[model samples]
Target: MKKLAAGNWKMNGLAAHLSEAEALAGAHAQPGCEVLICPPATLIARMAQTLGDAPIALGGQDCHSADSGAHTGDVSAVMLKDAGASYVILGHSERRTDHKETDAAVRVKTEAAWRSNLTAIVCIGETLAEREDGKTLDVVGTQMKGALPDGCTAENVVVAYEPVWAIGTGKVPTMEQIAEVHDFMRTELTARFGDAAAGIRLLYGGSVKPDNADEIFAVSNVDGALVGGASLKADDFGGIIGALERA
Candidate 1:
C-alpha cells in the first residue's frame, strides 16, 4: 500500500488559507507518498481548484449518513463528492466528543462515503483516562470493530489511530507505545479482514509535528501521519511531508 500523509485541518482555514494550500501543492508537485488535506467544508471546492494538477488530494472533515435530507447543519457524502472531495474523514475524536458521535454513526457515515465513491478515513483511539486505566487496546479495538463497515477494502478504507488526549495537547506516545498500538491494529485487521488487511494503510494522528514525523514514520506499521496544527501552514506540513518521503 502507498504511504499516506493526511492533514486534518478540523474547523480551521478560511479563503485566505488557500494560498498555503497552493504553496504546499506547488512545493511538492511530486510527493513520494499519497498526500491529502482535509480542510473545512467551506474550502474544499476552492482548494480542489487551487490544487489543480498537483499530486495532492482533497478531503472533507465529516459527512452525514444520509445521501440527502433535511438534516439542517449536516453535509452529506454526496455533497462532499460534488464539492470535489475524493475522501472524507469519519469518527474523528473531536467529532466523537464534541457532537456525541457513536461508532454506529461512524459506520453508517463510512458506508455513505463509499456510496459516493469517497474513501473513508475512519479514526479510532482511546481517551487519556482510558490509557491511564490500561484500556488503550480495548477501547481502540472496540471502536475499530464497530466503526468499520463490512466489505471494506484498502482501496476505500483507511484507519487512523489518534489518542484523544494527544491530539492537540502536545503530548505524544513513546515510540514503543506507538509501535505496540499500530502492531495491534495490524493484527486485528489481519484477523478480521484476512490478507486484504496488508494493503490497508494505518496512520498515527496526534500532535504530529515535523520534528517527530520522520521517527514516527520509521516505527513498525506506522504508514504515515494525520497531522493537526502543523498542517495549517505550508512550511510545517511540507517539512513533515518531506520526512515521510524520506522514510
Candidate 2:
C-alpha cells in the first residue's frame, strides 16, 4: 500500500498561504508516497488551481453530514466535493470539542463523505484525562466502533490517531506508546472488517514535525502521518513528506 503524508492546515491558511501550498506542490511533483493537503475550505478551490497537474491532492478540514439543507454556516460533503476536495477530515479533536461532535455524528458525516465520492479521514484519539486514566485503547476503540461506517475500504477511509494532549503542545508520546495504539487499532479493525482492514491506512497525528517524522514512520503499522503545525510551511511539510518517502 502507498503511504500517505496528510497535512491538516486546520483553521489556518488564507489566500496569502496559498504560496506555501504551491511551493509544496512544485517541490514534490512526483513524491514516492501519496501527498495530501487539507487547507481551510475557503482555499480548496484556489489551492486546487495552484496545484493543477501536481501529484498532491486537496482536501477539506470538515463538512456537514447533510448534502444540502438550511444548516447555516455549514458546508456539506457534496459542497466540499464540488469545491475540488477529494477528502475531508471528520471528528477532529477541535471539532469534537468546539462543536460537541459525537462519534455517531462523525459516522454519519463519514457516510455523507462517501455519498459525495469523497474519502473520509476519520480522526479518533483519547483526551489527556482519558490517557491519564489508562483508557486510551478503550476510548479510541469505542470511538472507532461508532465513528466509522460499515463498508469502509482503503479507497474511501483513513484513520488518524491524534493524542489530544500532544497536538500543538510539542509533546510526543514515546515510540512505544504510539506503536501500542496503532497496533491495537489495526487489530481492532481487522477483527471488525477482516481482509479489508489491512489496506486501511493508519496515520499518527499530533506534534508530527519533520524532526521526528522519520522515527514515527518507522514504527510498526504506521502507514503515515496526519501533520498539524508543521504542515503550514512548505519547507516543514516537505521535510516530513521526504521522511515518509524514505519510510
Candidate 3:
C-alpha cells in the first residue's frame, strides 16, 4: 500500500495562511507518498484552489454523520465533498474530548463519509489514565472496532493512532510503545477485515515533528504520520513528507 502523510491544521489558519499552503504545493509538487492537508472547514475550497493541479489532496477536519439535516454549526460530509475535500477526519481526540463524541458517532460519520464518496480518516487512541492503568490496548481496540464500519477498505478508510496524552504535550511514546500499539492495531484489523486490512494505511499522530519523523516512520506498521502543530508550516511538514518518501 502507498504511504500517506496527513496534516491536520486543526482550528488554525486564516486567509493569509493560504500562502503557506501555496508554498507547500510549490515545494513538493510531486511527492513519493500520498500527501494530504486537512485545514479548517473555512479554507478547504480556497486551499484547493491554491493547490491547483498540485499532487496534494485536501481534507476536512470533521463532518456530520448525516448527509443533510438540522445540525446547525455542523458541516455535513456532503458539504465537505462539495467544498473540494476528498477526505474527512472523523473522531479526532479533540472532537471526542471537546464535543463528547462517541465511537458509535464516529462510525456513523465514517459511513456518511463513504456515502458521499469521501474517504474517512478515523482517529483512535487511549487516554493518559487508560495508558497508565494498563488499558491502552483495550481502549484503542474497542475504539477501532466501534469507529470503523463494515465496508471499510484500503480505498476509503485510513486509521490514525493518536495517544491523547501525547498530543501537543511534546512527550512522545518510546519507539517500542509505538510499535506495540501499531502492531496490535494491525493484528486487530487483519482479524476483523481479513485480507483488506493489509492494504489499509496506519498513521501515527501526536506531536509528530520533522526532527523525530524518521525514527517514528522506521517503526513497524507505521505507514506514515498524521502531523499536528508541525503541519502548520510548509517547511516543517515537507520534512515529514520527505521522511515518509524515504521510508
lDDT, residue 135, model 2 = 98
Q: In candidate 3, which residue pairs clash?
A: none
lDDT of 2 by residue, 86-165 (tens): 99999999999999999999999999999999999999999899999999999999999999999988999999999999
The lDDT values for all models are 0.93, 0.94, 0.94
Model 2, position 122: C-alpha lDDT score: 98
Q: Estimate each model's TM-score.
A: 0.99, 0.99, 0.99
Predicted candidate 1 versus true structure: per-residue lDDT over 121-190, tens digit per residue: 9999999899999999999999999999987889999999999999899999999999999999999999
Candidate 2 segments whose C-alpha is farther than 4 A from its true place: none
Please report, as a residue range, the 10-residue window in candidate 3 with the lowest summed lDDT: 63-72
lDDT for 231 (candidate 2):
95
